[model samples]
Target: MDTYSFLRQLADSWALLALTLFFLGTIVWAFRPGSRDVHNDVADIPFRNETVPVDDADTPDTGAKS
Candidate 1:
């Protein structure tokens, strides 16, 4: 068989199977047991400092009249 035909056959079979397995493995890894705490921590990153008050010194004055 020619190179093109061989590559096409490989992509049509093994490549598809490999990609499907990879997708399933990723899903399984993400939803595995004992991972809720890690996921929750990452999810709360934006709100982690919510209780802290913002300092006015950190704000840049644009000099626009109120």
Candidate 2:
């Protein structure tokens, strides 16, 4: 019944359960209903800058000309 033994037992039991519940809760929250639009917007972030067409010929060529 010493401090170290008590802490070890509590951590091995309640702490483990708490962490597992927190992980499952996070998974549930991420896939919850009515969040598809928000998720889609976030997923499109990388392509946001690509919406405007880029013409390479019109841009300057910074390469050294031999």
Candidate 3:
């Protein structure tokens, strides 16, 4: 068979199966047990500095008049 045909068959079968397995494996790994604390820490990243209110003096002044 020609190179194109060989590559096409590989993509149609083995490549597809490999990609599907990789996707499922990622999902399983992300949702596995004992990962709650890690996930929660990452989720709270935005609110990490909530206790400290931002001061307006620390902000850069944009010349545009409000």
TM-score of each: 0.73, 0.72, 0.74
Task: List the lowest-lDDT window of 10 residues for candidate 3.
Answer: 47-56
Off by over 4 Å in 1: 51-66
lDDT tens per residue, model 3, 1-66? 999999999999999999999999999999999889999999999988787666889789988987
User: Candidate 2: where are CA atoms >4 Å away?
Assistant: 51-66
Task: Score residue 47 of candidate 2 by CA lDDT.
Answer: 86
Q: Please write out the lDDT profile of model 2 over residues 1-66, one tens digit for every residue.
A: 999999999999999999999999999999999989999999999988786666799889999999
lDDT tens readout by residue for model 1, 1-66: 999999999999999999999999999999999999999999999987687667879889989887
Better of 1 and 2 by TM-score: 1
Each candidate's lDDT (Cα)? 0.95, 0.95, 0.95
Residue 26, model 3: Cα distance from true site in angstroms: 0.4
Query: In model 2, how large is the Cα lDDT of residue 14?
Result: 100
For model 3 the local lDDT of residue 2 reads: 100
